[model samples]
Target chain A: MTKLFIPLDSFAVACGADTIAEEFKRLVADRKLSIEIVRNGSRGMAWLEPMIEVETPDGRIAYGPIEPGEAETLVDAGVLSGAGHEKRIGKVEEHPFFRAQTRHTFKRCGITDPLSLDDYKAHGGLKGLERAIGIGAETVIAEVTDSGLRGRGGAGFPTGIKWKTVAEAKGARKYIVANADEGDSGTFADRMIMEGDPYCLIEGMAIAGVATGATKGYIYLRSEYPVAIDVMREAISRAHQAGVLGASVLGSAHVFDIEVRVGAGAYVCGEETSLLDSLEGKRGQVRFKPPLPAIQGLFGMPTVINNVITLASTPEILSAGAAAYKDMGMGRSRGTIPIQLGGNVRHGGLFEAPFGMTLGEIVNEIGGGTASGRPVRAVQVGGPLGAYFPVSLFDTPFDYEAFAAKDGLIGHAGIVVFDDTVDMMAQAKFAFEFCAIESCGKCTPCRVGAVRGYETVKKIIDGEHPAENLVLVEDLCNTMKFGSLCALGGFTPYPVMSAIRHFPEDFHGEPMRVAAE
Target chain B: MVFQARYDEAEAAEIIGEHRHLEGPLLPILHGIQERFGHVSEEAVRQVAAALNLTRAEVHGVVTFYHDFRKAPAGRHVLKVCRAEACQAAGGDAIAGAIETALGVKFGETTPDGQVTLEAVYCLGLCATAPSAMLDRRIVGRLSEAKIGALVEEARL
Candidate 1:
């Protein structure tokens, strides 16, 4: 029987794919098409789904965002016609968007059954966890270290270093945390991981637990990812029932349990310390450093907190052997990162590539320029905290050191591309405004400076006190950068500074000509 | 809007006792009560306060901290328009303007009719299909001027 996988991602919700899925099953039965159609999570490309992939002798042939009218023709066209459609953009793998990626963590995304453990297992799912359980924790960490795995969440910290910290920490009680607070604007890779392959995250956490001697784990998820929360909750309960969790993990004495704590909307909570605070049922506020979360975290216990991509990659690194995983990237940053390609881009989705691809290749070659077919302009990497890199910096490699050298951070590897029509000034104002809104209201510079900065930006845009306001904005940005308590305030300058420095023309109140017209 | 904040000592204890039988029922029971009372009631707070061996202030502290755990009633309908960059890029600001004009209420303010409240949200992850809005908890996207008006009309009935 041909297995028909229908992606049930949020885009599917927007596209009304659920009704289509039920109708599809009914139609298949009526038509007596010898096929098995399964509803699964989308393949990350939101524009292309409600997209159906029909199993054929050759491979999975695709169709739609399929309208009811086209469903019959899809099957009639040999189901494997892999028919050329406007949405197809031709072969799935042939598309530069997917081709540029090295999808180790996201290998099964949009391709396999997101809800099926059996399909997951068939595609080398629990194999890494199996090896980890078979060999024990120390070996698992070693394999990860050898694979050169780094946290896919911004900061690019070595995953091995994190696991080792918790593994060696002297504590009877330990905690494993999954940072599912994907607060970055252009980022969706973390959400995709949580939504699509939650099992990978679970197994990765289990391995961390067994390796580090931690017994309890918590996945601190943002409430925005309601679907992820629901799916992960269901997956956790199933894992518990299957003995994948509890006292005997995979029938071993390594007893570790995991729970999901849905975080109220707080961007600051994405920070490890704030996340810990929120987990303890406290306000989603940031705490001062000196006691790093890995050391004294979550009820003052030694905690191993990692981003979604880090946990997901751990399973693959162990299963595929370390060298194979390590052979991808350059410099200190290694392994694959599932970069979220989005915003005003033509071919947008998730691009999982190594650490050293150029922005030009990514935005132009991979993304195919602007979504509206305008001339390519600026691209923002990282999150809101990241700088706007003009075409001048497109030659800059995506690695940590390379980007940092150019005064930008890779952050979570989210690339937001914009066309010439984009207004940098408004975008700059929004950054300060966002910081003002989400700033947890902890410290003065961030709390006061953000709103002040927005006001100054408004002044500049209104063409009031142009010279003085410009100076004021710059001075204010510097203060926020140096004085703020956290990245929320400290890094708001990247956009503001970049807009003023690289694209000063944008902030000059409509260029005098456009407004008059 | 119905859920009240748990404020007093005895009330907190009562609240905790009320939700004791639920399965790992601390958050759910608290949320349920909060939903019903606008915020967790004082009685509920005190009840939860006692059951968890926490102080009344502690319970209140947690409730007030989370933005979702409201201390007062919400309008009958909440129209949370996404203020994320993707949506903003796709004309969210224009949509926000139309909403403000139509409802005569600014962001984070409720209507006098108790019918609606408008608030700003970061990202709903509905960027690919941008210019989205969340009516209550449902994510609604591909939003335009006409769609927003139609939605308000539908919610009226």
Candidate 2:
């Protein structure tokens, strides 16, 4: 019997994958064809979503972005035999979009049955936990330490050091928290992992638990991702049943279990401390540092808080050993980063590769320029708090240190491209507006300064003392950058100041164009 | 219009009991009440506060802080349009204005007949497609004027 693969990833479903799947199933049943339909994760080529694959003697042939009513046309054209169709994109792995780069963390995302433990294991899923358990906690920590793995959750802190701190902290209970509150606009890697290869995260968390002696874990997922929440909850339950979780993980002496805690739409909660407070049933507000989360976190117990990709990256690190991951990247940034390319890009999707790829290569070459077929104006590499880079700065490498040196951040690695028609002044105002809306109101500089920032930018747009207002905007950003409690306020300046610095013409020119028009 | 019964004391308590055992059960309990009752009413908030042994101020603060929990019942259908940067980059502003004109209501407003409620969401994590929206549980991506019109029609139905 032949098998057909369709993605259940949220992006795919949003693009009408569910309807297409139903159509395929109806067609398959009507003909009573000896065919099996498998609901797999997305291939990350989101442009080609609702993309389906057919099992052939040579390989799985791909076709996609299939319309709601196109399944019948495909079947009639001998799709079951991998026959030629206008929609066919050849083998997915061989596509230029996919064939170019590394795919360690996302290796199993699109290929495997998202919920099948058997499929997960077949794709080398739990080997990290196995290695961690076999090697013991200290060696597990050592492996991660030697791997040079840093947090993929924008901060870029060393994961091994965080685990080491938690392992050594004097607490009766330790917790491992995965920040699934991927509130960044252009980023969805965390949501993709949670929906596509949830087992990868579970296994990674289990390894963290084993490594740091943390007995319990929680995934503070955003409520925006209802699909991820449902999928993660089910995946956790299944893991418990399969002995991959629970009192004795994999039937070992080490005890570890995980639960899914949904956030109530607070973006600030993506900050680790606020997430802890939200998990504790309190208002999600940023807590002041000094008692860092690793030292005193989640009910004052030692905790290891990492992003979804940070934890998801661990299974492969432990399974493949530290050196295997260590040898992959450049400078201080080691290992592959899953770069989410979005906005006006023609070929928008996830691209995971080692650090040091130039921004120019990523936006122009890999992304195939803008979808509008217009001149590329700006690319915002990172989430809301990231700096906007002009085409002149496209030569900048996609590394944490390099970005930081450029007064930018590789925040969550979400690159949203913009065409020349964009209004930078409006974008600058939106940076403040977004900060004002999402600010936790815990710190004065952020809470009050953001409102002031928005007003000042509006003044500049209105040509009210453009020179003075511009100075005021810079002055306000400086205060927020230095005084704010967390990244929400601190990094708001990146977008605001970068917009002013690079696109000075927008700030000074004839009456600023309205963004909504 | 979708008919939702006013919050009942006993039913709210029962919903609270189901999630009370979990660690930090307030959010879950609140979610359960809203899931069953369509929105977290003042009475339900009081019930949750008393059940969780916390003050109403604390519970109310939490309820207000997060954007997800609603204080009253929405229209029969809720349509959330993405107002975030990625969506805005994909001509979302025009789409948003078009939908508001078609529905005769702005963001955060419900239609006169209670057919649909309009909302603005930051991001739905479908940036690769850009310009996404969620009509209740079903998320739609690559949203255009035509698609938004269809979504509003579906919601009205």
Candidate 3:
């Protein structure tokens, strides 16, 4: 009779959504009401998590941050009729946070049952696969090329070119590897898609297989995401049973299937080469490029490795056409980027907007500033390796090339805000420490240089030869930036150097005052 | 105390056999072994190496490389606190200190009664609710001193 939706996404679950769901089930049974609860993926407005939506004749009504104890009170107040309660935040789509987002890739995430193929197809799912299968492999690559989709894994390489390279490369059997190892700290776009809308990723990977003539696909997911791992495994099995996977996909002659491989807790495995090595049951180490993964990859066969978001965006690009997808954003970044706002922000969640929104709008207007109610000191755009942008650079637009021009990276687009109380010196040290911990030790610059960087920053923090060590730190960073094999060592200097550049007062003689006294 | 059924070579071999058909079966087999027993023992490594037709050094290297694999049994429960930048920005240092004091054990150490083992993790992707931690597969976020105290008490049980 009546239907209620609750999120099964990990973030919601962590916030006690499961307990609240159970409470609702018990209350419904006790009252003998004709009500049904559907477990849906999160709407990404994490602040209002454990958010329950009730389906009415008009539309779905939303209420949230529902504590387990409040379920009884809310339901007793005739929540089924979409009655006004203090918790009711009206239709979710009308909310400021949801309204502002462009929501191209994440269109169906917060809505629909993630596992139901009928629901997926009902909400514009398999149109892309059908279109790809109809257009043939060459046309699929051409469409992707026209869409201007680049690697969302932070490299910004053209996805169409990669597929074309794999398609023409001389190989009897090719492979499609989805780099789902989302180890970046403030990033969870990959995790959300995998848990919320797995078929979207599965469909994208299948399209890649059809386009590249690759039959086998593997999703190298991180072990930290146990819930995503479980959801994906079940989703893959369901896809196989429904003919979305396995031989003769959707009754076509294009034989393609997918497998979910878990990564051992190695952050370095996020690198394409390191992920392939880990997939082969070897130590997760980076391999030198000359022959990139597109040419020789995954057991020495040409492999098309695309990030979760990059692959997930394809279903829409194929369904909506390349021009529709291409016309949304500014310049080269011609699509919606799912920017994850976290840390000390008041309204921390995923904001999917087209490129060209200034950092000021994102932090102040959308995020509503810090949760601590203090003046914002710095915002770290990207992950641990990304630079810390001061308030002065808040005018910088959310674009790939723009961030690079600012001597920073839009890596994975995870913007973490910090209040005025943050210590930039400690943050600088952490940049090096994180590198030292996660480095694959492939190159001496990353492995040893990181340790030295950490120690050098520590010396600066202790006010030891502050002038001399600052120069030493700069020289060491230059060495690592030039000599390192991968971004793990190369880009680490972004945070370290940016901290010194933007907030020099923190890095000099302040902590030593107590010792001097 | 940590519940570890004595390591059986036959059981380890059976788990290894289950995954041998897949491409790159070592990591999965090791995961299977660790799940069966609390830790990956030296003898288990030897059996896996022999079964996979690889050197013992190779298997050992893999086990050591990844942070997830354990060489010995842990306490009854494992607690991992987030140490990444996002968490650090959200009073994570205070959370870390409070948990250590509450549990009477440091990051990589187990309590005296073998009740809980505390460890530090980079991130759990719960940055939205910053200052997060995972206790025995259940994630607790937006952590404060009181929440962590309760978590420590739950681990003891």
Candidate 4:
């Protein structure tokens, strides 16, 4: 039977891919067509979603943004033979969006069947785990250290160093926790990975388990991502059944089993300590550090906590060799980063590239500017905690250090674009509001200061002694920056301060004040 | 009208018992209770606290800390509108006003007729097609006034 590929991923389903899939199935059954439908993950070019691929002699031909009603038209136009039609976008590989990406971590995402173990292995999967098991624990740590891989989750700390700490820390039962509480706005790379190639995560976590001698692991996922939770649970069960997980992994002496823990809609749970708290069936609040999670974590044992991307990226680093992974990018940010282009961008999706590209190249070149066809005003790199950059800073390269130099962050590499119509002051206010709502109420600066910050921003917006309120807002931000225990309150200043500095005009006047007005 | 099931102590105990063996079972137990009953009642919290050997305050604190947990039953349909940066950049602020006006209910308020409960969420990760909303558990993206109106009407029916 001829293979027909369609994405059953959440993004595709949200964009009506399910309806299209159903329509295709109906057509196949009614017409007695010799075609088998394979559900795949999204290609990350979300604009072209409901993207259908037909395996032909010329390779997989692409057609997309297809509706259920268009199935008949596609069939009539001989889509089965890769015949050209208005909807046909030619070979999938040649598409500029796909061509531009240097997909390392997401290599098998759109190409292979997500849940199929055979499909995963066929596309160079488990090779890393196989190699890792052969090299043993000490060598695996050394290889990771040599690769200079840093945590992809916000803080860019050296991943090898963290693993070494957890490896050496004494405990009867050490734990490896995969922080999947991805609450950041303009970010979905983690979600995509979990839903796409879950085995890679399992493989990555397994490598950590073997390297660190941890027998158990837990994935602390957010409740918002119901689909991810379901997919991961299924994937873990499959892995256990296939002997890739549980006792005697891959028929080796090592044993590692994983559990899925769901967070109850707390963004603060994304923080390492807070995640641990939530994992332990308590309130998702930040814990005071000095006895950092590496040394003493999760049930008072040494635990290795790494973000989803950081863990998912490990298999390739091991299989491809450290030097090969190290040679890809500029500066300290080695290896490819999956940049999620979102918000008002014309071509918003997940774009994986090495870290040297400038923001202007990403927003204007890759993203094709704003979807509204308006002039780009500002872009918020990272999540809500990241600073909003005016178009003037678009020349900044997509590096962690480079972004930090400008008081910005590359947190999760989620870039949210805004057109000229945006009001920076309102964006600033929302940051404070988000912090206040999501704060775990563990520390006064984040808990109380955020509320004060929100009120201060409102005062400025109300034009109540605008200059005085601005100063007050600055003071409150400084307190929160210095006093908050975690990034929740600390980095809330990035958006607030950046807005006041870059777009003073918006704060100087009444609410909804535009630059032109 | 909104469906409100009276909290059953026996049912809560069974749900709690099912998850008690897990490493950290309180969250799963609480989630299970909420899932079955639509909301976690004060009585359920008391029972959970007793079973877990924790204070009532501790259980209450956990429930209130997270946004997903509800203290009371929601309307027939819960409509969560995205109010994050991505949605805001795509006219989400304006859409918020439009939705509130159309439904005659503000964010976090249930409609008087109990057909819809409006809530504001940070992001739905549907940034590519911004101005997204979740009606029940289904995400609808690239929203407009007409589309939201149709969704509200469908929910009402």
Candidate 5:
């Protein structure tokens, strides 16, 4: 029987995919259709989610953005036979969005049954772990180091260096913690990985355990992603049962086990140190560094804390030789980066491309311009902590150093677009308000300066001595940038300063000034 | 008006006992208590503190630090509207305004009848399908004024 697929991932579910899937299933059952229904993960082309795929003789035929009401029309069109239909988007692999991506980490995401270990292995799943075990721990670290894999968790730190630190640190027990607290507004790659191919994350962590001699691992996931949490919990239990995890992983002498810890609603907990604190059942506050997480972390033991993307990408680096992975990207950003296009974009989804793709190419060409069909005004690359870039800077390539050189960051590679109607001054103000709301309150500059910065921005918006207020806002941003303990306060200036500098027009027109005059 | 619910020590103990064996049990225990009791009460905090061999202040600090944990029971239905940039780009601001007007309350405020509570969440990771909201635990995306109204009506029942 031909297999019919529907996405049960949260993104698809949000678009009422569950209802559509149920209706489709019911319709098929009523019609006595011999098609077998399979609930799969999203294809990352979220614009066409609830995308149904049929295993045709040729390939997987794709149709999408299906609603519950469209079930009857789909049946009438005989979609099971892969016949022509209005929603049919041709072969799944032939779609421009999927075709353009150099998907290494996300290869198995939308392909295999997420819960099936056999499917995972068939699709080149545990090859990395098997390779790592044969090569031994030192060789695994060497391969990662030679591959030049930097932390995909916005910081861009070298992954090999971090593992080496934990390996060398004198501790009886070390821990590998995956930071799954994906609180970034425009980013959801981590959630997708955990939900789509959870086994990959498990294998990656197990490999880390082998390399660092850390026996235990923890994936600190945010509470917002209930689907990811459930998927990961189930995947971890299955891994343990299958000997892929717990006491001799993959039949090796190395023993490694993983636990899924849920974070309460704290965005700062996404920060490595704060995540450790939250994992320890304390307030999600930033801790002073110097005894950085590598040396002193997680109950004062040496820790290997990396982002979800960083860990998930580990298996690929191990399985494929370091040189093969290194040959893909330009400059220092070696390997593929999953660029999340979101906000007002026409074709918003996850695009995993090699580095050096300019912002203009991503926003205009691949993204298909604004979703509202309006003139694109500004785009915020990275998370809330990233700078807002105008159309003039669209030529900036997707590289960590390149963005930093332009006073911007390719943080997590999340691009949130804005149209002509957006108010940059308001966006600047929201940055401060967001900081004020989510501040850990451990430091003075972030906790108090953010509140002051909000008031100053408000004054500027009100045109209350616009020139002076603007200067004061600048000074406050500097103080927060320099004095803040963590990235929460340090990077808030990216949005605030970039807005004031690039879009000064929005900060004008104060009714209060006119009234005073 | 603020709505408060009394905490049960027995219930708190049961919740704590369920998660106390985990490596770091405090977060799990707190989450359990909040999930079961609808909020972490002062009495529940004291009970958890006693059970975990910690101070009530520490427990209270943790409860108040995270935005997810509520101090009192929410309305029967919790409506979380996305106010992040992605949603805003999709006219979420206007949708939020219409919701406030229709519900006769601002964000974080529950209806006087205690049927619905409106809250503002940063992002629900549904940027591709912009203008999303979560009613209770279910995500509703690509919302419009009429759809939100229907959702509110259904939530009230």
Candidate 6:
């Protein structure tokens, strides 16, 4: 039997499409037409939704944003026989937006129904888990290590090293924790993962459990992303039903499970230790890490804590083999980055690409420049803590070493673009005050220095004793950077310093408008 | 820190007990207590501390640590204006000024009428709809100073 597959893509309008695909299926059954109807995730070319893609020798033909009323015409027009609307985007793969992405983690995103297991399998979803299940723990760790996949949650720490630490640690009660607290300014990759490909994260966590000997896993989510939390929980529950997460997963010796924990409203909980602190029924505070979470974490047990992106990248690395994952990026920053272009950018969304792409390329070529159409003046990489880059250094590559070489860190791959209209002083102050508000207050330098830094920056902007406050502010940042307990306090200097370095004129204000130092 | 005037031990216990068995239930418990009693009571924190076998300092550390978990109750409505770079680029300062002028209260302070509490939300992920303000968890995007008052008023806090 020569079979045909027709995918009806519409979520909000699914009730209508349901009737149509059903009729199409009924019509097929009645006419003895060999056809398969599948409900898939939106192609994101939302204008052309309720789209039906029918397979044939030529390629899949597209007909979309179709009303139930138009379903019959589409079918009559032989949409099932590789026919489509004249206005169709044509081949899904040929579409520029879909083609632009180097989608490793999000390969199947927007292509399959987020809720359907059968559709997910049809798209090569659990093959990674099935492949990973057969591999030994050491081999799994080696492949990930070779992949050089780093934590995409701001800090580019080697994910394989983190997993290896827990895998090597002696513990019967180990835990794998995924931080879905994407509270950063211009980041949604984590939220997108939870919404679009939640099963990927579940599979990654389960794979981490199999690798690290962790039986229990938990995803700590910030309350801001209520949708992700709901979707992730549902995915996790379904995993349990499918025997993908529960004891002896996929009928193997590996036993794993996950539960979702909601953060009431804490951004600091996105930090791993703070997340564990919140997980342990305490306030979200950073712990002084000598023992590290891998050795002793989350109930004082050995834990493999990784950001959502870090874990999500793992299943693909293990499944595709390290060479395939590693072959993409430059130098030590292997594997593709799912950079989230947020803020004033025109085409802001998740763009997965190789590491060597320049800031200018990402902002201009992929991002289509600032949404306001003004000259792109500055960009803050990572999150609030990342430094602002001036137009002078737009050639900087998207990598840990590259960003660090330019005195910045790819903290979570969150790139916030700004047009010429932004004031540097205010954004600089937010970094300091963010540190102040979210500080654990365990260290005097961060607790005291952050407030001091905020005030000094305010003084600089006010232009009262400008030179003195500028000196004092730099001094405060230096103290906090060097003396603080963790990155929260340490990295606040990146933005403040860069704003001063790049946009010194903004801090100086009009020279005539300035007061005495 | 003054003890909350409306702190009820039984109610707080009921709230804490509800999510006690949940995984990492601290945040939900804290949220529940804050929701019921107008603020997180010392008694409740102590109860959490005791229930979880954690030190009061640890519970306090967690409470004082995150910007979201309040040691005290929030105002009837939360008006969170985006203060991140994306919003700023799209004119967040003007919106903030208008809100400050309208509410007669600065960021983090609740208006005396208990109508609204103005806070800074770093990013609402509605950057495409920049210059956004979240009115008590409901995201309102593509905002301006002129539009903020009506949006704030619509919340009826």
Residue runs of model 2 more than 4 Å from their true location after superposition: A510-517, B1-3
Model 6 DockQ (Cα-based): 0.32
Q: Candidate 5's residue-wise lDDT over A106-218, tens digit each?
A: 98898888888998999999999999999998999999999889999899999999999898898989999999998888888998888889999999998899899999999
CAPRI-style docking class of model 6 based on DockQ: acceptable
TM-score-superior candidate, 5 or 6: 5
As for DockQ, the candidate ahead, 1 or 5, is 5
Compared with the true structure, what per-residue lDDT tens digits does model 4 show for residues A401-502? 999998899999999999999988888889999999999998999999999999988887787888778878888888999999999999999999888877
Question: For each prediction, how big is the interface RMSD?
Answer: 2.8, 0.7, 0.8, 1.0, 0.9, 4.9
Candidate 5 residue-wise lDDT at B116: 89
Interface RMSD of 4: 1.0
lDDT of each: 0.77, 0.91, 0.90, 0.89, 0.89, 0.76
Off by over 4 Å in 3: A509-517, B1-3
Q: What are the TM values for chain B, all candidates?
A: 0.77, 0.95, 0.96, 0.94, 0.93, 0.87
Clashing pairs in 5: none
Clashing pairs in 3: none
TM-score (C-alpha) between model 1 and the true structure: 0.90
For model 3, how does the per-residue alpha-carbon lDDT over A143-203 read when each residue is reduced to its tens digit?
9999999899998999999999999998879999999998888898999998889999999
TM-score of 3: 0.98
- In candidate 1, the second chain superimposes onto the true chain B with a TM-score of 0.77
Tell how far residue B42 is off in model 3, in angstroms: 0.3
lDDT digits (tens) for residues B6-51 of candidate 6: 8777877788789988867777788777766667767877988898
Provide per-model DockQ scores.
0.39, 0.86, 0.81, 0.76, 0.76, 0.32
